[model samples]
Target: MTTAIDSLLQILDLETLEHNLFRGRSPQVGWQRVFGGQVIGQALVAASRTVVEDRQVHSLHGYFMRPGDPSVPIIYEVDRIRDGGSFTTRRVVAVQHGQAIFSMSASFKVPEEGFDHQIGMPEVPMPEDLPSEKEMAARMPDTVPENIRKYWERERPIELRPVDLTHYFSSKALPPKQYVWVRASSALPDDPRIHQCVLAYASDMTLLDTSMFPHGKSVFLPEIQAASLDHAMWFHRPFRADEWLLYAEDSPSAYGALGMNRGLLYNRDGVLVASTAQEGLIRRKKPRE
Candidate 1:
């Protein structure tokens, strides 16, 4: 039941080579040198190793400098920017082919009291009521594509129920916003770190595609080449990733081969738990003669 994407998520384990240098490996998932989310997740895990348990990551910002090569391993060099009593920050540079392919800045903060407020979760069909992405793909197997079918077959760590699957694959132009209910496939442990990491891994799945909704382009479209360029995430409060959460994403702009999208994650109780923004390449191919 596990898909290639699910297996990719599990390969982010980091091995320490020195005080600041870490070693990481990624299996090739076809033509994509490497999935953007994999580097983000691995970089996060490498950063987490340097911080204390009392501190939790509240924000992470990353930029993709170039495509990664899955044929080789990536070396992460973490720079300890600042380690304060209440806050710690790390800069991670992921290197391959003797060059930096990805870089990220992460900030961790100890628990602190602050004003709390969040928008309510929208009312949407439950997972049981809606069909799984795989089921929907089965209806139009062509939409799933052969190159990416392995990704669809992989085990998903997060459950995603598209509010309107038909509108998603159809050529009809539609609104730029999308709503999906997501949560960890299995009940997570008590540790909040695990939940945060799991959420980080799941956040990259379908967010960038929101930008293409108005253009009526499926992410699997063979003619279009999609790649994430940058990613940013902010944690608003402690929340469980295993519980039902609403992910509402919208594309604010797309131009010059780039697409920008933002997302708001709300817990089942209607509390906004996190916010995320990402920009990526959405280059379309010229029609062949």
Candidate 2:
């Protein structure tokens, strides 16, 4: 694995503090608050550790209660709600500074053969045909904003190749839709749970940004205030994070200073492996007095 992926795996590996409790920390990446996806993925890891091996996570719902303190360690407390013959439920709360910052509920189920069907993946150019992150950065060194350029240049665990790059540097109002090819930067362990957690981490990367496409704004913009409020995901099938997957996302509505977006994850073979929905705060900043 690459150093970035190794660091990501290490962060996901929570420390066992006691029964039903684990400790997780954030990378000192110069962010004011912890990334919502990191909390979600770590909380899932905490919940999965309490579940049986046969029971795999099928769905999860989470809410951001408060901004997480990135400089401190988060304490995850898992509650084993119920364990049935086919399904298991676990609740997790992430705490920092002795207060709850995020909470999540996850459902796990045993594998059972059933009728399978999924929406066909949209026709788009393959990741191989798209410009790599470094290439894009080098091509438009002056056009890309400083913050966005820094993000793209960073050695992230997941690599993203967007089908359309116009939204990054342009402010033209367009349809609220986006497609990006995503995959782990390096090979990961064969554990399905790890892949799921990694997918959960990557899912939060750009879903909320789709809502801003119609307004020609982005979370990276300093004048726009954005933060994820709630997030939900459903794992429909097993998939490898190291393999490329298409994240098809669109925003259905944006009102009351909030934007609602949904996404579907399809593997290379056009199999829909997961679905995600999220609502976030997307209010514009007021002029200074």
Candidate 3:
């Protein structure tokens, strides 16, 4: 039986159409727009396939040009920008309906020892102590909004255990910060590339919600239209996606209909494995008569 994780892997596994060209399909999950994380991960995979395995992705920056269409396959066109002795760079553009929807650049490096220091992870309740998403949903079935309930109650490849449940229950304006424990629901193949891409896919999950916190809003609210605008990530160290990792996220500011979010991913052992930043559109839709 194929699990959600398996479906995710299949989605990331782009079909090679030709040299420097690949095709990817979105899961027909009734979403109007393709998930931003999916495009990022697929673009990264497209870039990685062209580079040698000795090198691993160290960082990536991407911009969303338009909302992706879930009805069609996206074509990823990879450009081999440069291949140096120690670093290799590639640019990828995802297209659908004859229009470019996303573009990204990724850098890969051959593993080497380097001076390393990272800010310590914030202390938070262990994932075991936090209520599982399922348990939380079961306990608050009536409290959660219908649209959000549909999304939360479904089986997902990645699982999240939020440090605080207040954000889901209240609309009171609060601090622009959040912490969640995230991990794959099932064991994944022992491939570092797979892990990295999986993490990339999961990074965009809830960071945007931080931005809405100060306004006492949620991206799921119909009155609020939200979408990722741009995303950037840096992988500092190796980590398994199937293991518990703390996702500490915050929004420093939101203005002119945009919100900026930042996140740090730390392994259970408190090793900082990756960091990401994204700015997204969180504009409220005006009501019409």
RMSD of each: 2.6, 1.0, 0.8
By summed lDDT, the worst window of 10 consecutive residues in model 1 runs over 3-12
Candidates arranged by lDDT, highest first: 2, 3, 1
Model 2 per-residue lDDT tens digits across residues 183-202: 99999999999999999999
Candidate 2 deviant stretches above 4 angstroms: none
Candidate with better lDDT, 1 vs 2: 2
Q: Lowest-lDDT window of 10 residues in candidate 2? A: 1-10
For candidate 3, lDDT tens digit of each residue in 172-217?
9989999999999899999899999999999999999999998889
Q: What's model 1's TM-score?
A: 0.90
Model 3 scores a C-alpha lDDT of: 0.95
Q: Write the per-residue lDDT of candidate 1 for residues 45-68, one digit (tens) a residue.
A: 889888999999999999999998
Cα lDDT of all candidates, in order? 0.83, 0.95, 0.95
Clashing pairs in 2: none
